[model samples]
Target chain A: MSVLEVNHVSKSFGSNTILQDINLAFEENKIYGLLGRNGAGKSTLLNIMTNRIFPDAGDVKLDSENINDNDTKLGLMYLMSEVNLYSNGTTLKQIISDTELMYGDFDHSFAARLIDEFGIDINQKFGKLSTGYNSIFKLILALCVPVKFVLLDEPVLGLDANHRELFYSELIQSYSDNPRTFIISTHLIEEVANIISDVIVLDQGRIMLDQPVEDVLAKTHSVVGPAKDVERYTKGLNVIGHDTMGTIKANYVYGDLDDRPLPDTVQLSNFDLQKLFIFLTNKYEGSMHSEN
Target chain B: MKTNQVTKYLFKKQIVLLGELYLFAFAIIFLLPLLLSVISGTLSDYSFVGLLKGAHIAALFGIFMIAISTLSYENFKFLIQNGISRKTFFEAQLTVYGILILIGNTINLFYDYLIVVPLTHASTFNTFMSLYADFFDNPFVSVTFNFIFSALLLVFGALAGMTVGSFMTLFSKLTQRIILIATPVVGVVTMAYVANATNNAHYQMSWVVNFAKFIIGENGNDVLNPFPMMGFLLVLSAIMIVIIRYLFAKKQLKKA
Candidate 1:
């Protein structure tokens, strides 16, 4: 069953609409990636889904009930990138105590273990911590909070390479152990591409693409060959993206790659998420060829 | 977690915010008196009794600062975003701010007795206590009156600040930028008005003397008892709090 449903939701600031008629459904026990460009209303959508921001129109429901209902039965948690814990004079230990008090299922032991693993100082004030550590601290709390639906918005924005790897590892482990619905909204598509079971691409406050990772991957492929041959072979195909180097050309094609073998001068390659995202998002200016 | 669970989280946030405000209050209270004494070239003969009285008045400034600092645009935005009922959040902040001010006053009074008294003259402690006794002589009447007046000032300040903060948050970025420039100008105008109202020749002004009477009690000759005024202030404050809470609850959490 779907764990989250947003139905024709719209949000406007004064007369300027930020999100319009956005609709989506998310299932349980799956890792979903929410991909969008900046100001595409990705965070706004997440905020509305998590009940942080109310929609101007329509409704967002969790477990078949309006999320704003005071039932206390729906387990939902949102970790926003902007709404951080107190930055100054609050120790990690104090934050843990406060979290435990706030979240009934907050696991202190798990938090402590994560803190140790992340090498965070228990006595250091949150304000004094580096940006990477600050993000880690929030991540630790987010993971330990036992909520059925967890929404993480750009969780790795400020982390170092090593910490990002560590965070992803911990996130995967936590999801495996808990089996909850996790919606991760990020611009770093390539980093989370392999782990995301489902993908939702948002563009201009609307769902541009929503499908299982396998289905999405299946529809996209890259063809590389001599420039002239590659162009000729992909002439009638839906080309999402393309690149060229001198006489060589590479093209990202949408739809079944297995239905047709590569031409003699062309080689077929599997599409990666980075290339796919670039192709899908950068397809506006005649970058994608229509099958017509 | 239950709805009550969020209260605990909010209280923790309140404590952290209050601590910062308390420190800010202390710095202002301690520094102002010292700065005034130095500027007057009376540092050598600075009377502890005078300093104690000044500190008491300075401590009251914390109520204003607390009102301004706590009801910030970001805080209101946060309260709305977190799904905290505005009534609950406002009451929580008021409760927290009241507690912090009381604690801050106690500390200021203590520091007056300990440091200021010793630095100037220990003999003046009795005089200071007498003044305090005179100020708080009729415990039931004086306490009721002062409490009501203080609560009114706090609520008024908080509401005004919240109104401005909310406006800033709801307005466009360009408007906010403009208001950022106008804020200090508005502040200066308010100070000028206050100065004119409290000038010596205008000391008999009904509002001025009424406010002073609430703070320091009747100046021995005043025939008007402040009990009714106290009751009126209390009722007004309660009404304002309710209105502010209602507005805040219904207001949208618009982003800047």
Candidate 2:
């Protein structure tokens, strides 16, 4: 069943429209990746879904009820990059106390354990923590909280490589243990490619792609062959992106890869999420520029 | 569960704010007086009794400051974004502030009796009784005049703070900018008004002037009339608070 449903939602700031007639549904017990470029309205859509911000038109429902009627649906943890916990005088212990107070099922023990694992000083004030540690601390809290849904916006934005790997491992482990809905929104698409069960690509506030991760990967393939042969073979297919090198060519093609056979000389590779995102956004940009 | 959640959140917030208030009160009551006593020694002849009275007045002013400062844009934003309703939040703040003011007043009264009276070799009980008499004299008159005037000042200060805080919320992107620009302008305008009013006798006694006098304790006509001015300020404050709560209830948090 869909745990979250956003229907025909539109949002505008003055004359600049942010989200336009967007619709999406989130299923329970799945890890979904929400990917987009900067200023693509991904965060705005998340805010509307979480009831942090109201939409100009349309409604978001959680568990079949309007979110505004019961904003406790916001009790569903939303760890946005911008919506920081207190800084200056606030400590991790105080934050835990606050979280336990505000949320019914906050796992204090789990949070403590995660804090220990992340090497966060419980006594240190939030403002004193390094940027990477700040992100780690927030991620730990989001993972430990026993809410029905958890939305992590750019959770690993400041993490080093090691911490990023550790974050993904902990996130996966937590999901496996609790089996709740998790929506991870980030520009770092490839980092979460393995963990996300579903992928939703947003562009200009519209959902460009929403499908199972496996299906999305299977539908797109990269072809490397002679430039003329690649162009001829890629004709009538949706070529997301292409590059040429000394009479040889590489093209990112989107379609049912399993349904067609390529020439023996052509090298085929599975499309990575990062490459897919870059291709899609670049394609949109190219089209817009051409139109202009 | 809802009550527990709100209480916990509000309690945490209040604890932090109270710490700041204590520091502020300590500075104003203990430190400032000590500095003044050292600077001129003008208060040296007054004895501790006068010092206690001064402290009592300072404490009352501190309570007013605390009440006003508690209403902020951050608090409003939290109320709107979190599941906590604006009505509930405002009621909680009012309840907390009222309790705090009562406690502060009690402590001040105790200090007046315990420390001031003995030091001055004065009858503290007699002073208390006289003050009470002063408060209730001509039941209708004193109630209308002094008591109501002071109450209105407190309410007006709080309403002013909340209204300004609400306006600050609208300039969310450039809150610091707005504050930086508006603070000096407000300060200058207020000073200019004060200077102008002190020089103009007719302007001072106008109905507007009388109302301002009633607020600031400058009205010389002390025929102990139940200060309807206090009721006026209270009702005005109540209206502003209601409007503030309504606007806050409808507000939404900005997106990530």
Candidate 3:
């Protein structure tokens, strides 16, 4: 059964509709990648699910129970976003203690290890921390909080390459040790591509694609060869996007590859997640541009 | 039990943060004035002791500001992000209000008993709103009256603080801007009216005068006893809670 269900959720700010008819369900013990471009309503949908902001219509449910103003259901989820809800004078240690108070038990030993690995001073005031350290500290709290579901928006915003690698490994370790659902919204598509099992793509305040990572990749195939031969080979299929380099061409297709033999000049390869995401989003943008 | 745990945690955080603010305000409002008085060697007509007592009132107002500032969106969001719902957060704030009122009035009582009554040599200390000094004729009764009366003052300040904070939180940008510009004008106009009424006996600023008289156990040459002002405060507290809850329910946390 789905642990969390977002049904027909819609939100608007003034004249701008932030989310429109968003329907989603998250199963237990899966890493879900929430992929969307800037201003694509990923954060808005996350905020709505967590009840930080009210939706204009529809509702979010956790375990068949409404999440809004329901302490028991809300207690089952935690959201760590870019906004620093904490005040300037609060120390990291104090924040952790406060989190423990609210959420019952916390993984203190793992948190301490993460803190040491990240070289963060627990006594330092929140406002004194640098930008990268801010994200790191929030990530630590997100990982340690004893909630069944954790939603992280732009979780790795300001991390260096080394820190990002360390975070991913630690996340995997934690998930393996204690299986729980994690919905991470981020722009670094390639980094989380392997880590995430399910992928949900949002564009222009609407869900464009939602499927398993392997399934999405399997459906999207790339045909590369001479420009004319590639076109002939992918004549009737759904061509999402294409790139031309001198005499060679690569056309991305999103449909079942037929059993019919192809020309020798044409080559086919499995679609990478990053390439598939770019082509899918760009295809939607291209349609929008044409419509406008 | 969960609600109690969240309330306890929130109360501790607010108290620590407010304790820092109170210390800072004490330095500026109370200590600075005392230092100036000491350096000048009682140059003013009023006794240095009276000046010090007056500074304590100013410090109380300063604490009220601290309380209002602490009830901000940043703090509210912090509480909610930690899995505390808005309902729980509101309940926690109510607890905070009680805490502030209790601690504030207790400190005021301690000051009146330990410092004002024993150390000061003044024959009479005229408390502006409560006539607390008049109660001094009966030492035991005076302490009791002062505690009750000071609690009322602290309640008023606490209510005002929460109201100001909720007003700032719930209003739109345009409404907030208008309020920011209009508050000083309103204060000045009220002060002018109060000053004018002070001189004319016919004007009868009985709301202030009668309130003070009643708290100090007197009715001021009236045929009938005064209506209980404490009842009004209790009712006001209920109204304030409703208004604050409504405002909080409507408030939206904008991203920063």
Candidate 4:
């Protein structure tokens, strides 16, 4: 059993704190969704975890060994970010082969199958790849490398609907086949909500929520009815955020609902991961703004 | 072993690059000119090729190192992407460059002594002999001294390339432009001031001359005494290696 831990990590750029006291443990053989809005420090956290960037006041460790510039420890993890790090003249085949050399193991047949399935010409130079294809290639690297942990930052950037669907299915299949830990950071909450086993919501340089998705969804509810009735029904519950449309309203709650007689126009339904995420991040931002 | 693999790959590329460079250079300087002279029935005539044959092998290797080490940005990006520790890649690259420099200068030594001087009939092409033969009669002692001097220069060239590459990639465009413009202006102004002060005797300039001469020996003897120069170069190289290692410790991913 392998575990990657980010222990009390804090990073700041100039006066702006990117990540503040982030402490999380990722056990192997699970999928975690790292959800955040723009500039919520998702990328910064991922960079720090992968040793691509330094943390100001903490360390990331794999199996109890610090991974900062430790080749043996780092070799067990790979981070696929939205950066073109390969040489312009290198072909995709060559890059993949070189990656295999570095990590000592890569699923060549699976990679070959993926290239064919993705309609990618591996002979083409990496620089000439389209934005969508570039994302696809990086996703392939993330999938094929036989590492214990893989962190993907915006894995589906520039990917079209079909490609994103294909990628998600392949990701699920690969996870099932190998059972490595994957922590994905992306804005596409709805698309990855079902596949992700755990959800980590980041907001305002802090972790707003970190829980199993099923556990989170079990307590989350969308109370929809007349605005006054919905408010009355959820008066004591933890209301994260809500939406109002004229006389009607839907208050999103993060905790259990009270056992009260339902109002005539009131209705209760389980909210989705996206809705939960939206309300959670929105509420956190609101609190941050009020504090400032 | 992984470092060895990395060194192998990098050295392979450098070998290919050096081969191509030598092929092109030798063709222009030796082959083409020799052919032209032969065609014109002037095979024995003195020419530019003979003059250029005097270029030191170590210096040329240093030039080659600068070129490849400057392009090391490409390798850095690739290596860092693959999760190679900075220490691993740095050690691998420096080891490769060191070995290549050693082999390159050794080949130069052999080729000049055996082929160039014998064929061109020009002893001036023998750079090591000209530099050290006056002070040291023993070839072994002289060559050892020459090797240290050449190694220092190549290491400096390699370190300079790494610095330039890092500077180009790490800083913002505005900062780079400002530094680029400011550096030469400052250097020129300082040089003019130094020249003026030295000519007018306004500043004690003997320390300046003495400082330059300090590299020669303890007594500032410039006549074939390479012991002080060797000691100075070794210490300078040691300092540079330490500085370079420190700078390379914690580099994050910059924009490609």
Which sections of candidate 3 miss by over 4 Å?
A224-236, A244-249, A257-266, B17-66, B117-153, B171-175, B183-226
Per-residue alpha-carbon lDDT of candidate 2 for residues B33-141, written as tens digits (9 for 90 to 100):
7787778877665344455544555345555554555455555454443444444555666555555444544454456456665666544233223333354646556
Best by lDDT: 4
Give the alpha carbon lDDT tens digit for every residue of A80-132 in model 2.
Answer: 45566354567877776665565665776767777777788988887788889
In model 3, which residue pairs have backbone atoms overlapping below 3 Å? none
Clashes of each: 0, 10, 0, 0
Model 1 CA lDDT for position A135? 80
User: Candidate 4, after superposition: displacement of residue A86 in Å?
Assistant: 0.5
Candidate 4 per-residue lDDT over residues B171-201, each given as its tens digit: 6668878888998999999999989989999
Better of 3 and 4 by TM-score: 4
**Docking quality tier of model 3:** medium
Off by over 4 Å in 1: A11-18, A51-56, A68-75, A80-85, A221-272, A285-292, B1-46, B57-70, B73-88, B94-157, B164-177, B180-239, B246-256
lDDT of 2: 0.69
Q: For residue A273, what is the lDDT in candidate 4?
A: 92
> Cα miss at B96, model 4 (Å)?
1.0
Give candidate 3's error at residue B141 in angstroms.
7.4
Worst lDDT run of 10 residues, candidate 1 chain A, spans A69-78
Q: Can you rank all candidates by lDDT, best first?
A: 4, 3, 2, 1
| Fnat, one value per model | 0.14, 0.26, 0.76, 0.62
Q: What tier of docking accuracy does candidate 2 attain? A: acceptable
Q: How good is the docking of model 4, by CAPRI class?
A: medium
Chain A fold similarity by TM-score, each prediction: 0.87, 0.92, 0.96, 0.94
For residue A176, give model 2's deviation from the true position in Å: 1.2
